[model samples]
Target: MSQYKINVTKLNLWYKDFQALKDINLSIKSNLITAIIGPSGCGKSTLLRTFNRMNDLIEGVRIKGEVLIDGENILDSKIDLLSLRKKVGMVFQRPNPFALSIFENIAFSLRIQGIKDKKKIETFVEKSLKSVFLWDELKDKLKSSALSLSLEQKQRLCIARTLVTMPEVILMDEPCSSLDPLATLKIEELLQYLKKDYTIVIVTHNMQQASRVSDETGFMLLGELIEFGPTKEIFTNPKDKRTEDYISGRFG
Candidate 1:
């Protein structure tokens, strides 16, 4: 049987003098998509970063409780940080590609893991690009600089780069916020296809996107998780007043 991809218990986060997350508990099923939605500064992004320990790098940051991946606590001291990051890939809100050729950008992570086989690297690069439906558009420009691609293409390249390392869980922070409507639709379609093979956690302000892309939707407000369940239930018949108010566009 497949195990839970990520489990959080009584999780809380603080940035020195300010608290961002308050006792947030969530479980992400294996090979499924979970969307975190809330207004700005509501701690949706903070909770997403906790899955991969991205909060650890912030100065004066303190966390309480446990975050487990595959039955192991990633916050434990004995865990190797590098390996953990490899297994939990992250794609930021922007398409921050490297200043190199398209092929080089995709090959960067594999090379870091000490994979030096030329032919094998090439094949994997191609395969990863194809996973994001970008191989056909980029195959001819393998050696061209990544900066030459369109914004949507660059975002897809970032997805390809993350896939090259074969991460079990992918954390996306407003990944489609910068794209046009058509490009956003394509990414939403891609997310549906990718969830069959990898656990996905996405933070989005777009209510419609969350409803369309996530199997489970979590509504957070004022640093607290107000409601979480099947997307249909949360949207149609939320138990919490806060959830209803936010979803109904009464107020954020």
Candidate 2:
């Protein structure tokens, strides 16, 4: 039997009176990349946030159904959000590194979790940077300001920061959107390397990106999941006409 890292069962959400998600159901496999693709306002980001309860930061947001992580319901009142976020880190559409040094940005997350060993932080910082293929370029410059790096480096740094926490699942909301073609390809390569150890769920606007990076793909339209299956199957032999139309560039 396949082990699921995340299972969304009849998940629904509302931002005040406006319904954002309608009965979303998905099984995110362990150590694989699951891509969410859709047009604007299609509830892709909202659904991603549900895994770590990021949507709760917004006022008037309501949720129904359950998001199960490792068989534990994340929506329950007793869930520890801080611990949950540490286990399920998120990278936003744009790279938003802190003004601190690259090393500090990665180490800060560890410190906030109450880690105080200097040698451990240093060792893990190098490991995390190397994990994302950023160590050779940024290793000697660990003291440099994170804001000084280019867009791609910053994105990788953001990813490295998340990885330093040793999260079980990484949630990315259009993580490559702010990068150029070469940079985007690099991030995609990093994702391929990452999936060997961690489950990754990405929300992407680019169809090519979804097909290239995902093991499974889910298509959403107007707050509903239109079709979902293997990446090739979803892109090629979509069972739903709506999915076919969107995949073929007819309408999104």
lDDT of candidate 1 over 199-230, digit per residue (tens): 99999999999999999999999899989999
The prediction achieving the highest TM-score against the true structure is 2
89 in model 2: Cα distance from truth in Å? 0.8
Model 2 per-residue lDDT tens digits across residues 1-252? 258999888998999999999999989999999999999999999999999999999999999999899999999999999889989999999999999999999999889878899999999999999999999998899998999999999999999999987899999999999899999999999999999999999999899999999999999999999888999999989999998888899977
For every candidate in turn, the CA RMSD to the true structure comes to 1.1, 0.9
Which model scores highest in lDDT? Answer: 2
Q: Candidate 2 — which pairs collide?
A: none
Q: What's the lDDT for residue 69 in model 1?
A: 94
lDDT on C-alpha atoms for all candidate structures: 0.91, 0.94
Clashing pairs in 1: none
User: Per-residue error at 79 for model 2, in Å?
Assistant: 0.4
